[model samples]
Target chain A: MAQEKTYIEDIERTLYDIKNVDKSKYKSQSGLTEDIIRDISARKNDPEWMLEFRLKSLEVYNQLSLPNWGPDLSELNMDEIVTYVQPDAKMTGSWDEVPEDIKDTFDRLGIPEAEQTSLAGVGAQYDSEVVYHSIQEDLVKQGVIYTDMETALHEHEEIVRDHFMKLVPPKDHKFAALHGAVWSGGSFVYVPEGVHVEIPLQSYFRLNAAGAGQFEHTLIIVEKNASLHFIEGCSAPKYNVTNLHAGCVELFVNDGARLRYSTIENWSRNMMNLNTKRAVVGKDGVIEWVSGSFGSHVSMLYPCSVLKGENAKCEFTGVTFASKGQNLDTGASVIHCAPHTSANISTRTISKAGGKATYRSAVKVTKNAPYAKCSVNCESLMLDDISRSDTLPTMDIEGDEADIGHEATIGRISDEAIFYLMSRGISEDEARSMIVRGFVEPIAKELPLEYAVEMNNLVNIELEGTMG
Target chain B: MNKEIFSEIPMRTWNWLGVNEATVDKDLLVESQKLDIDIEADHHEKMVVEYRKESYGIVNISIGENASLKLTQLQLMPEERNHANEVNIVLEKKARLQLVAVETGAKSFASKVNIILKGDKSQADVSVLYFGDGDRSLDMNYVLDFQGRKTVGNLEVYGGLMGESQKIFRGTLDFKQGSKQAKGYEKENVVVLSKGVRNRSVPIMLSGEDDVVGNHAVSSGKINEDKLHYLMSRGLSPAEARKLVLEAAFNPVLELIEDEVLRQEIDSYIKERLENE
Candidate 1:
């Protein structure tokens, strides 16, 4: 008898592929220009300083050149992409007040359900504006602030002006400069000093306009000795034309504070997900990152942590599954600037059906970082001969007291492991799925229960096939 | 004098990190010699070549079916100067090549080795030992490209950096498509003995065949305190114990030197550098 070859299908994106009518109240013209930036600023009632910042960022964006490395981006045409789209709705504190079509989109994504049971506060952004945002009154009374970025800029101008874009400057990269120039809606979170938020706050971004861009700026500051967990989720409906997501996330963990940031990115195949995220940890502070990348035509994201204070620490756990036309380049970066700082990064990537996955990272220990330690481990699983996986990591140490170690392995599932499982009555396909699940188990367990289930479903190993 | 890119990584990453490639100002056009060696079928051969007198050179070696070759190259410049060298090798079916490279001399040295397993069942094992002291700078790139089924490749690098020295090492294991059942491993260890030294490393593994196995590891740090204390407890001074620890790290590669005379010369050179600390 001839053995049958097992094949795993690509992520089932049916639920997220639900398209909405183009009911946007306003949409920027295709192509970037000074006039467009000025119009956006005027329409948003921009503060004088914000307008100056936007103009300066636009200048920087023009001066910068495209990255000469990583996944190909020649297909991303700024000349044809609409920089912003305002959904036909106003910001509301209640989901019932949101427009029916927009609410339906988030409702299908289970945002409402996740908000009720799993999240303490929830903010949902549709296109270029936050449509719904709400936080529990009890938490608000505890001096915790969770609201849209625009609201924070207006209500807490001093704090927002101080921390916004400080961690991820516009000159960090070309896309970052573009984001700074035309960014729209995201979340702002602040936990009071020494206060620990018991539950996680979440922000969901849905890009509904075709050939458009979503540039959100999320700023979070956990004050001294305070702790918080924040989750972000993003997705888009598949369109024939390309879409862009150049969102930026900046986090500040103050002295003795701790912050955990988690994200699940499931963009459509025609989307270019070029996102930037970073955190600055203070003395005795800790930062943890949990990430899942399941969809995107091309993605280049590396969340970074700057250990600026002595004894600061960071932990990163992430997984990327690339199938068919996907190329997901993701990893973590750490910079140790103070004595006794440490960081550990672990990631797993799976490639199938002509997909490609690359893990690229950098670890730098400055001369002042005596006794700093960093360890990086990455594993890649290729599902077939047509796929590709690569690991590229760099370590730059300026002092002998710093210790850095990196290990990477690339291979496929062992036939013996599959055979052993089959001998125990499991089917071949089931056995393979089981093995892949076990490979990503470490990263999955780091996520919230619902997000983990979502990730497993995206990976096509959930056994139930419920989320699609 | 001119500056050129050397020791480029297989797949370029973020250029801002400056590890994608190395640029050095040197006279690569210095009078260099070309040496070629060929081993016939079923034959075993061993040879030692030194670049101290030659200064700059290129070496190419090819092994026929079922042949085995053990080759050692030494780069111990007699005076302070700059040079760039290249080595290319190809192996046939069932052929094997063991290459040991010891580099310890030169004001600035750049070296690249490219090995391709072109036939089934071929294997390549490469060992590199380098020492960077004084104001010397070293840039090295080693790549093992697997093109044949069932091929095996292993790479190991050991080095120490002191003084104001700087070093960058890029090692890659590439498994091309149709190279089924190929296995490759690369390991690099750098011991920094002083505070002013700078060390950078990029260990990359690229795979296009699912059935192939690829692994790479890199580590950089100061001398092991426990081992140093143990040696000091055994009737050695602090400096002596430090030297011993570094010598132990380079011993495995040094022992691979087939020529006794050449091996001792390289060993003594390493000792002289360590003693200056």
Candidate 2:
């Protein structure tokens, strides 16, 4: 009898691991201070009211305390981290007009190709500022405004001022205040009334600087009877030192409108990702979230949705994979505040190689939300004994007419299933990988074609060398 | 006048979804009991313990090898009185123990039960039923620790809350390292029958062995409308239909009392409570 061979191919991260030389034309000093915030505001040419808002947010950030739950953040020091980094390039509306090195980076990341093929618009941000932004002529003709946040603030001041940071206020948490204090480049989108954009708009964020923090604020609004789909993706190169990403996303779906938001975050192992996102739906409106978390040293992300009007609906589908040296705490939150509202949340997590994954969530049905319906399902799979998985869910229902259900399960892969698959002429490694792929198929099927393929490949790469 | 030394002592202090801290009144009398029995082969005994006043009591029991014990506890305190009760039990090899507890009336009630399976092949089963109404408060905690190989433990609780009443239930199943092939399970079901009632349930499972199984589940909601409608269509009044539903929900625990008269008394008490509501 021959022993089974263990295929130990390292998961290839070359596409995201490509780092450029440190050619920042402007860089803020290490540490967070009032002076640093003022300097960032000055560099971005913020208006007087915006500067005041930033100063007030800094005060709030100073008064706030770190969270006591989830992963430890004592390893992150604000004194050693630079709050802002600007690459040696200006914002451009055309890819060909972008700087050579930054354009090459996005080219290698396939951002420009994706823009040409599948996207209705594209915004690429390198480090702290968006370098290239473009939208199709038809979308512009249809009264859709998709551009960088800075441009939107200057051109469409009223709308930008009305919706910025309204959903996720600075007082929401510590990281939210930090984001408000020193936020940088992100995308801003608006669709007019009764206009339905058939294609999806994308924003790609690449943090190329080490020991620096990226705070991007994204605001999207779909007006009454309108519909749109937005996609966001982020990645960073590996470094010995730690990096921070505390971005915020606020979405508004008006009466009878619909919006779908999809995100794929794969930060390097040395990054701490503490992002916040929320959406508020009006009467007869709908909002959907599709999320995938694959990399990060520590992450505490739970996107929230508030159904604020009658007949509003929300759906959330998410998946997280934690390998070695990772603690990913991810889930979703929903609040039903109106009559006849409904929400559904489904999540799956995979942990291996001494990693830890915790699924924490909260669902609240207020007294006014009569006839509200909510269901939450969470499942975690631990591939080895060394790994750990936990689920903690809370439900508070005050309406007698509300219907709520929650279910959670944690376990390891079944040996009997593996044996059965092996007996049917499938290799052990292939069988195990197939099981994992099947575990996340429900979430993967909700993704776009390119992302679904990427998720499948990621599962295969994570299960490469576990056969014994 | 009885001379009493006073000290503020907090009760029900632990981790995981915590309940409100309470202090024991120093002026109340404390009563305790200890029982150690070693029964012979084929020996079986049934016992009933009742608490009816403002008092504190602790009972300890040990079952001998190859013996069995069945215990029913009743907390039937007066409407103006409060009571605190604790029970600890241990089982020997091939021994079995079954416990059924019912809490009906009290201003404030607190109870804790701990069971340990110390010998190989030991087994324990526990069921609890509680009803709260009219500003009453209930706190209950149950822990099962498995120390012997091939040991088994199961716990189930059913509760109903109405009016302005409140209740908290904490159930934990712990499987130690040496408890190979052990199995533990816990389930809790709670129904809130009216507005302003609060019900909290925390079910925990802690395992240190690889070959053991541990599971817990909790379901809290109102009675199904379809079930109620089915009974109402069968010529029963609305109140009668509700009483029948409550009976069916608690029949599993009532059937385990083993005393027919006591079971009937509880059934009548439940009917009376429902009629008042």
- TM-score of B-chain for each predicted structure, in order: 0.96, 0.89
Measured against the true structure, the TM-scores of the candidates, in listed sequence, are 0.97, 0.86
User: lDDT of all the models against the reference?
Assistant: 0.90, 0.81
Clashing pairs in 1: none
Writing each residue's lDDT as its tens digit, candidate 2 over A1-468 gives 432222222235788889999899899998889999999999999988888888889889899888756678988898888889998888888887888888888888788988889999999999999888899999999999999998999999899889989998898888899999999999999999999999999999999999999998899999999999999999999999999999999999999999999999889999999999999999999999999998789998999999998999999999988778988888888988999999999999877766777676767777778788888887777655455565556565653566667666555555677889999999887787777778899999999777887786766633444443
lDDT of 1 by residue, B1-277 (tens): 5877866888998887777776756566456789898989999998777787665689998999999989888898864778778899999999999999988988888889999999899999999999999888888999999999999999999999999898888899999998989999999999999999889898989989888989899989999999999999999999889888988999999888867888888888888888986
Any runs in candidate 1 off by more than 4 Å, and if so which?
A1-5, A422-429, A459-468
Candidate 2: CAPRI quality band: incorrect
Provide the DockQ value for model 1. Answer: 0.89
User: What is the clash count for each candidate, in the order shown?
Assistant: 0, 0
lDDT by residue (B53-160, candidate 2, tens digit) is 636667788887888989899888886886777788888888899999898878877778888998889999999999988888887878788899999998988877
Q: Which residue pairs in model 2 clash with each other?
A: none
* Model 1 DockQ class: high
> Mind giving the per-residue lDDT tens digits that candidate 1 earns over A1-468?
432234666767998899999999999899889898988888788888988888889999999999989999999999999998999999999899999999999999999999999899999999999999999898899999999999998999999999988988899999999999999999999999999998999999999999999999999999999999999999999999999999999999999999999999999999999999999999999999999998889999999999999999999999998889999999989999999999999999999889999998999899989999999999999877889998889888997899899999998878888789989999766887888789999999999998888767755642322110
